[model samples]
Target: MDRKEMECRLHERFSWLDSLDEQNSVLGLVFCKSGWYNLICEMLTEIEQVYNSKNLQLKSIDLYEIKEKYGTMQTDVGNCIPEVYEIVERYEAKSEGVCEVCGAEGSLHDIDEWLMVRCEKCFHERKRRFYKRGLIT
Candidate 1:
């Protein structure tokens, strides 16, 4: 199939992902475009990576063949991908009191203790600005 056709098929494959229940079970019949089964699997694998990291499972319906046999009902697809839960997990893993400016972790290097505990990037920028103004030797 052509690129547009392939994209449409992929879109249809993912479209069915939305109507699934919270438990990941299919709430209704799933469907997709013809000759794009592998593409659908690839997309599912990508989604699995992000979801698996957060210990969450994504429910998917294998409707590639079904769509080929039955055909797609709608032409336009919708935006309904599930939220990436791994980001929250990653954020929670960060050290407490970490400096948002410089990524420095620990209360000892906090702004109150050192005037400012900027991250390495921010520190360099500040120094560059200070030298430009002849404020520091």
Candidate 2:
């Protein structure tokens, strides 16, 4: 079948998984289409080239386990994985803040100096003093 038809069929068959907002579900549909089949195959082969270029760690897990847990065998296996953006936000929050430039704690400052968000205490001290000097160039 054509890509559009394939996508339509996949979507119709897997509407419930679509409700879960799973990336793999979308990827699976894209991967299975005649039009996207070659593209996604290449994309998967060179996934690192598109994102996470360095230190690529391509791996696969058992779909049967996922099917057993979620009762569907589509790409998402029931859309259980968290969104990438959410995971990144959680990581940032847990990591606290260190200076991106100098690795100083609490020294990171915004351009306007109005917000003193989570930085290390030493970094904040420097930023506060620097703000007073008008030398935060």
Candidate 3:
């Protein structure tokens, strides 16, 4: 999904995202896909709620592929917290079998020899959209 759709979903789930922005707790938050963004925020929200850390801040949350076989989530909370990495690992494991482009049951597919776990339906949808936008030739 696009920015508006992502923001709409985020706002629906956790209204604090906007407030966090105003409080300067969220920085450099951009370009994250909708599902991944939700997963990351869900983790952080749990941390914030459990620790009750009023001073909590997020430095960054980045997702990238590793060797075309796995995906990684790099998150930096302002302060050290226990079990946070473990929680991140759980989410990573969950993402592995899921489509990166859409939250569907998907395994890796080779597109131009690049591996991506996207369902056949979304694969076609994304391909069509890209072609229509002249992003593909």
Best candidate, lDDT-wise? 3
Between which residue pairs do clashes occur in model 3?
none
* CA lDDT, every model vs. true structure: 0.40, 0.34, 0.53
* 2 or 3, greater by TM-score: 3
**TM-score for every candidate vs. truth?**
0.25, 0.24, 0.53
Lowest lDDT sum, 10 consecutive residues, model 3, at 59-68
Predicted candidate 3 versus true structure: per-residue lDDT over 1-137, tens digit per residue: 76456555555565444423554444333344544665656765765565455454433322222112334334433334555566656766665566666667766565545556677887787778777888778
Each prediction's number of clashing residue pairs: 1, 8, 0
Which regions of candidate 3 are displaced past 4 Å? 4-27, 53-78, 124-137
Best by TM-score: 3
**In the order shown, what is each candidate's alpha-carbon RMSD?**
17.8, 16.9, 6.3
Clashing pairs in 2: 105-120, 105-123, 106-119, 106-120, 106-123, 106-124, 107-123, 107-124
lDDT by residue (1-137, candidate 2, tens digit) is 65455555544543322322444443323322142232223322333232345442323211111110111112322222233224333323422343322333432245454433224554566567887998775
Error of 1 at 94 (Å): 35
Q: How far in Å is the alpha carbon of 23 misplaced in model 3?
A: 11
